[model samples]
Target: MNYEGAVYRPPSEARSLIIQVTIGCSHNKCTFCYMYKNKQFRVRKIEDIKNDLDESRIQYREVKRIFLADGDALALKTDKLKEILEYIKLIFPECERVGIYTSPQNILRKSVDDLVLLSSLGLGIAYLGLESGSDTVLENVKKGVTSSDMIEAGKKVVKAGIKLSIMVISGLGGRELWKKHAVESARILNEIKPNYIGLLTLLVEPETEMFKQIQAGEFQLLKAKEVLLETKELLNRLTVDGCTFRSNHASNYLNLAGELNEDKERLLKQIDDALSWKFGTKDEMYRRL
Candidate 1:
């Protein structure tokens, strides 16, 4: 299959067939994100996408899932998205689900009826980055949406019967506002009650605004212990039921996964056990590695 630029999909969609329905992220201005900085955002043409699907149909014997790439494929018009989903149904009858990354703006702009329509057409799950629930932190990081907007967008997807996987960064607010960040993020998550919660620790890579901020002393990234504390606070405040929580990303200092409400106590204990280890201070232990 033909491809353009770097492709990214949710870690859960690693085994799924990936097609670039759009190139780059439509909103590529988040200060902490460098994912789509190298490319311009543009929607791929319908026929070109169909051709790629046609090619993939011959190359693979069976495909259980397909993920639309890159960034926000939900930015496409409803009719166009419906067409693509319809074609996917026509060509890959055995495919179980289709997933895409979506921005809060895209979700908010599309009415629930539109999302419901898309869901009926095979758009199964959506990945949204709710970097922080603190509007101040969201503004500081240039995430381009308010916490309320993020909550509304997340709920919109859920109300439409689409599986929502929301990602929240552990240290997004830095040391200054970490507590506010944790509490507000948990509150927002409880309000939305997404099907999945993905916890990621912030990684300030080169060539991003965040790196410049750190150089200029405008941001203070959290230490390992602080991150664990923030995670615990966020976890303690969460009351959502039947949601899968995962923090297994490579960027995370501690990888965790479990169902919420039921596994909350066990997960907290796991963090406490790590905290109680007599080897050394949490920061020092991590630093020695």
Candidate 2:
């Protein structure tokens, strides 16, 4: 099989399949993201995408799940996305689900009909980078979409009957607007009440605008303890119904998992226990690894 030119799959996708149908992120303007900067954003031709699927099926037939990449496969036109989905179904008839990363800006542009069509074509889940629900925070980070826009867009996606996984970054507003970031983000999540809420701790990758702010001492990054406090505050404010929460990344100093309705109190207790123990010590941070 020709593995050449295919991007490496992230370890996070060990249980899923990776299908590259796009070259890079459609909106690479988010300040904290460095994932797609090395390449320009463009959708691959349907034939090329089908070829990649053919190659994958030749090696591992009948996979149950897949993740379309690079960065926001939904950015493709609805017809193209549907064509790829049809090819996927033809190739892997046993495939049960498929997901893709999506930018709120891209989603906002899509009509409800387009979203419903994609959902009906087996685009089961979407990973959305709803970094912050504070308009100020979003603009400060150049997220390219406002809090209201995200809410409206998220509502449409949900209305289309697709499972939504919304992600927010802790410490995104750094220290200046930490409270706003936490509160506004929680409010948005509460409104959307997505199927899943994934929390990501911010990391300033080199060459991004955020990294320059850090070097110039313009943005004060939150301490690990400070981030935890902000996370706890955000969690305290989130009152979503039946949402699953996860911060399953090495970047997070602490990991958590809970359902909104069933384990909210338990998750809060876990956070409180960790906090009361004076846990954000340097030792604790390293030990979490």
Candidate 3:
């Protein structure tokens, strides 16, 4: 496949075949993100995309999954996305699912009918970054959307029969707003009730605005115990039934995974163990973005 600067997909899509349908994030203004800073945003040519698909058919014999990359594949026009989906069905009849990353703006741009059409055409799941559900944190980080906007967008995706995977940063509120961040994030998750909820801890990278803020002593990162306490509070507030929750990302201090409501107590107990120093967190030296 023809790849661009940097391609990113959900960790669950680790084994899937990836193709860049877009060059970079269309709204690459999140202060915490530096993933696509070096690349310009643009939809790839339809012909080039098709060529890559054709080459992939020749390369892999039994492709089961495909992940559209870089950042916002759903930002493409409805007709254009339909064409790509149709071609994928024709070329890889056995492919079971196709997933993509979508921002709130991308979701808002597409009509419900457009989303339904895409879902019907084998677009199985969409990964959305909620970042933080606290409006203060969101605005501070320039997430470009409110908590309510994300909730509405997530509901739309679910209404269209597309599985939604929502991600939130654990320490996004920093030390000052940690409590509000935790509670509001849980509130948003309870409202959306997404199929998947991924909790990733914050890791400020070099060259990003967040890194500069940390350097200037403007933002205070949460300590390991504080992160656990925040997560426990968030989990305690979460009431979404049947929602799968995961916080096992390499960036997370603790690895937590289970279905909500049922395993809530177990997860909370694990957090307690970590807080009491009975269990350990991922070493800070090993954490990554």
Candidate 4:
């Protein structure tokens, strides 16, 4: 595939065929993000994307899932997205599901009707990052969305019959607002009750603004114990059911996975073990973003 720069997707989408529909993230101003810093944001030409799809059809046999990458593929207009999805259905008849990175702004810009139309066209899931549910933390990191915005966007995806996979950063609020971050995030997730919740711990890159803040003592990094404490609070407040939850990301200190409510106690106990030094935590040398 003709990729412009670094491509990222949900870990669950590891085996899917990745197609770069957009060059970079539409809003790359988030202080914690460094993924698209080297690339400019732009949607590729319809014909060029089609060409890549055509080439992939010949190179790969029996492709089942496709993930649209290069940051927020859902930014494309409904008509344009419909055209690309239609072509995918035409060429990859066996493709069971399609997924994409989505931003709250993009999700809200498109009407419910637009989202439903795409869902009917085989767009199976969308990944949204709700780094922190605290409005102060959101504005601090420049995520460009409030907790309300996150809830609205998440509900829209669920309403459209599209699976919503949300990412929540464990220590985005750091020491200053850790409790608020944990409880408020759980409240937002409880409201939306997304299909999946992928928990990630905060780790700053030197190139990003967050790194500067840390150096200046403006923000704090939660230690392993504090992270577990925050996570425990978050999980404790979560009352959602049937949603898949995973915290085994490379940046995380703990590894956790299970269905919500059903395995809530088990997950909390695992965190307690880690906090109490009974269970192991990932070493800093091996932990990464």
Off-target runs (Cα >4 Å) in candidate 4 are: 278-289
Query: Per-prediction count of colliding residue pairs?
Result: 0, 0, 0, 0
Q: What is the C-alpha RMSD of each candidate to the true structure, in Å?
A: 1.6, 2.0, 2.3, 2.2
- Show pairs that collide, candidate 3: none
Candidate 1, 1-289: lDDT as tens digits: 7689778888999999999999999889999899899989999999999999999999998989999989898999999999999999998999999999999999999999999999998899999999899999999988889999998999999999999999999999999999999999999999999999999999989999999999999999988878888999999999999999998898887778999989999999978876675445645666643
Per TM-score, what order, best first?
Answer: 1, 4, 3, 2
Model 2 alpha-carbon miss at residue 32, Å: 1.4
Q: Any runs in candidate 3 off by more than 4 Å, and if so which? A: 278-289
- Off by more than 4 A, model 2: 1-12, 279-284
How many collisions between residues are there in candidate 2? 0
List model 3 lDDT by residue over 146-212, tens digit each.
9989988999999999999999999889999999999999999999999999999998899799999
How close is every model to the real structure, measured as TM-score? 0.97, 0.94, 0.96, 0.96
TM-score of decoy 3: 0.96
Query: What would you estimate as the lDDT of candidate 3?
Result: 0.91
User: In candidate 2, how many Å is residue 135 off?
Assistant: 0.7
Find the 10 residues in a row with the least total lDDT in model 2: 1-10
